[model samples]
Target: MSPLNALNWRYAVKQFANTTLHPQQLEPLLEAIRLSPGAFGLQPYRLLLISNPELRSNLLLHSMGQNKVTKASHLLVFAAVQQIDEAFVADHIECMTQQRGGTAEEYQGLEAHLNGYFRNMSDQEKVRWADQQVFLALGNCLTSAALLGIDSCPMTGFNPEGYDQVLGLAEQGLRSVATCALGERHAEDAAADLPKVRLPAQVLTRVLV
Candidate 1:
């Protein structure tokens, strides 16, 4: 099916069936998110794939009473890196050097640029910036799931601090920003039959030219 068709066929699944997505079905969606773009290519976030029933049960408590948190086959938490500093920028540059067959020193200019950019932002602004990167990954996950004939529900109606504690994110220098629940929609989900509500193209966007 075309991308447009896949998107039209997908929705924010409200009820998930008692079905687990096979590894084959789950990996590609993960790859799509792995390839998601981010500001400065820093990709200042981590994807937490949670499948442990016990952990999911713990997370459900922080999920605003959303059973989908536990019912979905897998829970993907997008966590922003709490630090986007010189050390982080240097690491990314070194990675680029290794991947592209160059010396880390050769990428010093690029590394300096990224470090300077982050240095100007206040701590709170840096946090917000990293959180924004997580959303880009979330969008990629949603689209990839739809294209792969999987159901997904992106959610933010949860407690972040609670998640950080339950997931031990703070010590890892990460903070939860958003989550996506992946699985098969329940057969009796009324939401599956509801029409999508969206604004017309003219209202939603405009041509600059």
Candidate 2:
């Protein structure tokens, strides 16, 4: 199906089927996030894959009893780095350089430039920067799932402090920015039959020419 058609078919899945997604179906979703576009290619986010039943059940509490958290086959928590220091930027540059067949000196110089740029930003600015990266990843994941005919829900209705504590993310210097639940749609979900709701093109579009 075309991208437009895939998007039209997608919805914020409120219920999920009991069947788990196969590895073949799951890998592409992951790959989409791994290759997601980010500002300056910093990719400052981490995707946590939770498939354990007990853990998912525990997370339901932190997520304010969102049934999707426990019902979905996989819960993806998108997190951003709490801090970006010189070392982190340097390491990322080095990895990219190696992948692109660049020399050490070339990568080091690039890293230096990145470090200088990030160091000049305020703490709030850094947080905003990282948050934007997480959103990019989330968008990519959602689109990918839609194209694959998988049911998903993009969620931001969780307790961040409780989540961080339960996930032990502070120890890794990461904080939750958003989450998504992926699985098959429950057979009896009434929302599945609802028509798509959207604004008309005239209201949402603009012609500058």
Candidate 3:
């Protein structure tokens, strides 16, 4: 299907069928997330793909028993770094060096700039900034999933604290910011048949002259 049509057809699937996505169908969704853009290219988040049934059941408790939490074939948790420091900057710089075949010396300017900017911010500020970036990645993931004909539901109703402990995120200095449950939609899902409601484009958008 065309991207526009695919988007129009997509919705937050409330009822998932008992089906697992093929690897071919799953690969693009993962790639879209891996390639998601972040502020300053820092990518200050980690994408945790959870397929373990036992873990999903536990997560459902933290998610207020949202059916999709356990019914969906795959769960994608977007985790933001709790803090940004020189160490974080250095890691990205090193990865860039290997990916682009440049010396670490070539990235010193960028590294210094990022390190200084992050260091000046308080922990609260860093977390807020990282959280914002995670949402951007969430948007990308949702749109890409739609284009791939996958059923997805974006969720932020869960308890991050519960998730961190259950998923053992504190050790990694990551915190869950959002989640996306993906699978095939149930045939009886009435939500899938409802017309999407949105304000008309003219009323919802404005172009400054």
Candidate 4:
């Protein structure tokens, strides 16, 4: 199916059936997240995949009792890194050398440049930047899941503090920013019958020239 058609078929799935996505079905979705675009090629967030039923149950509590949190085959918690420092920037630049076959000498000033840029940002600013990057990745995951006929929902109605505590994020210098659940949609989903409502393209677009 074309990408537009796949997007048309997708919705914010609120409930799920008993079906689970196999690894083959889930891989592409994961890949899409891995390939999502980020600012300055810096993906300052991490994806925590939760499959344990017990952990999902705990997450459901923090998610305001959203059943899909536990009902879905897996819960993907998108967490933002707590801080960005010189060492972290250097490590990423070092990784670039391995991928692109360059010596660190060629990248000498890159890490410090990034460090200086980040140093200008407050702690809250850094977290906000990471959170924005997480959502970009979430968009990729959701689009890939839709194309693969997997149901999903991007959720923000949960408690971030509760998630941070339950997931022990502080130990890893990460904090939950957003979440998405993947699975098969329940048959009784009334939302499936409703037509998507949106403003027409004319009203939503503008031509500068």
lDDT of 3 by residue, 1-209 (tens): 78889889899999999999888998998899889888777799999988899999899889988979889989999998876888889999999998988899988999989988988999899989998999999999989998888999999999999999999999998999999999999999999999999999999999899
RMSD of 3: 1.0
lDDT by residue for model 1 over 25-129, one digit each (tens)? 998989988999988777898889999999999999999999999999999999988877888988898889888988987888888888888889999999888
C-alpha lDDT score of every prediction, in listed order: 0.92, 0.88, 0.91, 0.88
| lDDT, residue 184, candidate 1 | 98
Instruction: State residue 70's C-alpha deviation in candidate 1, in Å.
Output: 0.6
Ranked by lDDT from best down, the candidates are 1, 3, 2, 4
Model 1, residue 118: distance off in Å is: 0.9
The runs of at least 3 residues in candidate 1 whose Cα sits more than 4 Å from the true structure, single-residue gaps closed, are none
Residue 4, candidate 4: C-alpha displacement in angstroms: 0.6
Candidate 2 stretches with Cα past 4 Å from truth are none
> Any idea what lDDT model 2 has?
0.88
User: What's model 2's TM-score?
Assistant: 0.95
lDDT tens readout by residue for model 2, 36-111? 8987788887889999988888788889789999899899999888878887887787788779886778777778
lDDT of 2 at 128: 90
Model 2 / residue 73 / CA error / Å: 0.9
In Å, residue 133's CA in model 3 sits off its true spot by: 1.0
On residues 88-115, what C-alpha lDDT tens digit does candidate 4 reach at each position?
7987998899998889989878776888
- Residue 175's lDDT within candidate 4 is 89
> What is the model-wide C-alpha lDDT for candidate 3?
0.91
lDDT of 1: 0.92
RMSD values for the candidates in order, in angstroms, are: 0.9, 1.2, 1.0, 1.1
For model 4, the stretches where C-alpha displacement exceeds 4 angstroms are none
